[model samples]
Target: MKRRDILKLAALAGASAVVPGVLSEVRAGPIGHTGPYWITIQAGWGWDPTLFCDPKGAPVNATYDKAQIAKAGNIPYAPSNENDAFFGKYASRLCVVNGIELSTHQIEAAFRQMWTGALEPGYPSLAALLAAGLGGGAPMPLISAGGFEETAGLVPRTRLVGAQPLDWASLTAPSADMASLFSPMTETRIAQYRRERLKAKLATSLPPGIKSVIEAAEAAELSRPKLEQWKAHWPSPLSDDPSRALIQLTLAAFKAKLSVSANLWWMLDPAVTDAAQVENFNDWTARFDVLMDEIEAFGLDNSVILVASSGGGRTPMYLDEQMKGHWSVGSMLLLGPGIPGNRIIGGTDENLRGLPLDPSTLEPNPTGVRLRPAHIHRALRRLAGIEASAEAKAFPLDAEDLPLFS
Candidate 1:
């Protein structure tokens, strides 16, 4: 495998790749129809819950003072100038999670803990563990686009830093050129001959374990139709809206069954990377509207696990009218299978301190456990219907599974 490519196949007990003449055996789950795709959209810099999920009006955060707080079913959301449309249209499918406290207030430590539920390395990302468990035989089990999508080696994952159409082309061919993978084959018989020759050699010279690799490559070479279909469905990546461009790629990977799941981080224009900038939220608002629109248009709302979360929340105590420092408590949203519509779980005070809750009832309790990202993730695993899998068991959440989804 190439250095950047992640391919960790389970080695057969007795199969030896080192021996030139000995045949190696291998086993992998078979691929079939898959749905309820899992996705995690990490906004990177935390969002201010006071302006949204953990709604704290005025005195606490003045930015959303006049922005009417809208309630869709049971979910209360601040109808900010930009994101009102989403709340009005899809709040019925949303489950807002608030009062999430991170492990620390320091930048890097908090960022790591928010996603991986740990302050240091060695903890597998929830995305990685879930992908491997649900991934039957997807060529790419996990696809991580944009920011910090560390795999920690639980399964194969692909990271797309920027535009590189040829990267998709390289799936089947040795060269990173689209033409090489999908060019017309006028001499079909010659190709058949080569394949038959390889098949014949497979019984003798080629190790059995290597056969699947060769076959998969050939399968990908014939995937030009799927590529063309994606081209018709996605928008131009070089457009003004970078989020659509990135989301288009992510959606294609999932729809094409190229991967069992994908974790997409939205990297705003360098100028708008700061979540503290109110204007950035406007950009995000518009893009998020388009995101939900496309998801509904593509008919993925019921068949995909759409999650939105961040490192932490920006403090309500603003440095100025525009900038706010990081706060320990953050927010999360879950929308997909088994997640009831318009249910808001947990809460924070006007100052954004998490309230303790009855673990079983998920109601406020004076002396109960506080919520965190790990607790949410543990519930997420159960929602995906794979909490008991060995891959999931490998990364045990220290606390008992949170019953948020139920």
Candidate 2:
């Protein structure tokens, strides 16, 4: 098989293994992830950095003056009074990466590029890479509450959100009503017989394509038991807010050892055009703080790497519509155990254009490279210790490795 075909088959097998109805007699307990947990929060509809982290004055951002920029440690944030609480509380743990240059300003392409590190379609998302590599035997692996769900068929994406309760029993059960179905022991025996027949059938010579499908079926049978363990960790009453619901689900999964990475979406009010827009962003950050608080409460703070990135950025200069247009430059915030805190890496000029940086020192250099999503993904793979994994290799982000998390 060609390399791409092999990858596709492997991805297909992985995707198949997560299906809810795989039948097996073995009762394997839930597998937990003891390593670093990754959580990526993507801010939808383009976010304006000048309204939050990267501050400007007068013509750039008419709302805030350059002199009004607030300092929290080494990082300087927007002048919005509400931002003080967020920056002040988490600045010590936050590694702000500014001036990320996106190749395209189109929303769909920007979202794909920002999270997957590939401008073209078909690459697995960063969350997928983390799950495929570091997730180990996590049943759900990567729980994508919202935003990019592209997995390149590498792994299955599960959406466990909101106050709704999951019907775990129904997923694996033989029938809707137990009274009308075969007994549990009898059903288990029937499943075991079916698996044995499939195994015997696979023992005979077969075409590569058919053989791969059978192998995937066998893998799914082996993985069926893990799904039963999720019920113990499901939250009692989930939050109504989509973002908060994602956080709660991810944390519970982390605690249950059911997941490794999660992708979350930040849906800000796109209608707000004035100063309240800044507050809207500020309020979201405050909610982000609550995520950290709960992580700490669960004693998983040290093991979690938190990321909040924008799909794209709004222009520094206002357009004729009295609102900022899409800009090529973007920003990201990383926090957790290994990342250097209270530091700002990369930057932009007054016009919100990305600056070239010396990859080695991460300092501005006239003859250096501008930061891009690929560079960030490369660093992230290193952080997750998955740079050399087959999944990462399948979807390479050919960029110089900077010490982003060190």
Best by TM-score: 2
lDDT of 2 by residue, 254-371 (tens): 8777788888776546733646567568767777877887787668878999888877788766667676667778899999978899999989998788999997898999899989
Clashes of 2: 1
Task: Return the top candidate by lDDT.
Answer: 2
RMSD per candidate (Å) reads: 8.8, 7.9
Error of 1 at 44 (Å): 1.5
lDDT of each: 0.63, 0.73
Give Cα distance to truth, residue 59, candidate 1, Å: 2.0
lDDT minimum window of 10 residues, candidate 1: 9-18
Native RMSD of candidate 1 (Å): 8.8
| TM-score, structure 2 vs. true | 0.83
RMSD of 2: 7.9
lDDT (10s digit) by residue, model 1, range 1-406: 3313211110111111111111111112344536778778777666666666666667666655635666667877776645566677667888988898887898667777777766676766667777777873554567676566766766655554453222332233323333444545634544566557656655665565577556543444344333444334444322334455455655665666655677767534332223444555666566667776666766676677778877787776657545567788888888888888788899988678898889999998988889987888788888787889987777777765667988
- Model 1 TM-score is 0.75
* lDDT at residue 377 of model 2 (Cα atoms): 94
